[model samples]
Target: ADSLSCVRILRKMRERVSESISKMKADMSRAEEQARREYERERRHEYDSAAYLISMNKQSAEKSKAALPHLLTMSDHLGVDLLHLSGSALSTVFDMKEMSSLKS
Candidate 1:
């Protein structure tokens, strides 16, 4: 009878150990899932930010290009021919001043 009780105790201990192991495994799986979800959310946010930046850069490039014709017209009105001033120091000076003023 004592041997039987010992056997039963051993079995109960094994059962408890098994239950603890299973609980630990479940906890680990839940932690992994949460980590995966958080990583995915961060990746999506980074992708969205990158896409927005790309779109903004494209828009800015288009705007800059579009303004070129107006700049050329203004230079013509000022009697400054780019072709004639292609290698002139005065032309470079004027161009720099114009660009600085435009930024301001």
Candidate 2:
């Protein structure tokens, strides 16, 4: 009867050990899943930030493109005005030289 009790005790110990191992495996699986979720969240945040920056850059480029024709038109007008002013100044100088020659 004592040997039979010892066998039963051994079987109960084995069962407890098996239960502990299963519980540990479940805990490890939960931890791994939590870690994977956190990693995916971080990656999603990074992707969103990058996408926003790209969108802003695209808008800035389009604004610059839109301004180019107006800037070119203003530049052309300034060039024509400068040439007209230069011609007027040259004509005044020539008239002054002619008057001085006639007085002499």
Candidate 3:
């Protein structure tokens, strides 16, 4: 990884102990910043991905909530089959604990 590479480079610079020690120190600073930026970028990306999935799950739950009444009305017309179908649909939808977990 870039971090390990940075460490190796710093070790080499230290062992050499040439006139460019000052320049190597500056290089190390830059390497540290690069590693920090890379870490932040990866973290931000993961956060965004998780947030997007949570938003989608919440959207699906909202859709299911909205459809429940309509499903009930249709079930009244379709009888047992629709009743079972709606039950299965309800089970697939996220419950309160699931929603809370997604938020966290």
Candidate 4:
């Protein structure tokens, strides 16, 4: 009877241990999946930000293209030398040909 009781106790312990291991494995898998999802979310955000900047850059280039002729005319009428403008200000103007090359 004593040995039978010991055997039953051992079986119950084994069952509990198996359950605990399974629970641990499940928890680890969930943690890994969460980490993977977070990484994907971060990458998606980076791509979205890059796309937004590219769209803004294209819009700015178009506006510059449309305004260039009028701006040059005004500068000439006002006797303003564009070449004497600050380098930083000049850098904001994108030539259409230069912009095309940058896309590739």
In model 3, the Cα lDDT at residue 16 comes to 47
TM-score of each: 0.32, 0.31, 0.35, 0.34
Error of 1 at 35 (Å): 36
How would you encode candidate 3's per-residue C-alpha lDDT over 13-80 as one tens digit per residue? 33443333344334434544554565565566466766556555554454444444444454454342
Clashing pairs in 4: none
Order the candidate numbers by TM-score, best to worst: 3, 4, 1, 2
**How well is each residue in 11-93 modelled by candidate 2, as lDDT tens digits?**
55434444433443354345445544654655664667665555544433443343334323433643322122332332232
* lDDT tens digits by residue: candidate 4, 4-97: 8866764554344444334433543454455456556556646676655555555444434443443445446445554444434433332122
Give the local distance difference test score of model 1: 0.43
Compare the candidates by TM-score and give the number of the best one.
Answer: 3
Sort by lDDT, top down from the best = 4, 1, 3, 2
lDDT, candidate 4, equals 0.44
Q: Quick one: best lDDT, which candidate?
A: 4
lDDT score at residue 29, model 3, on the 0-100 scale: 45
- Per-residue error (Å), model 4, residue 102: 16
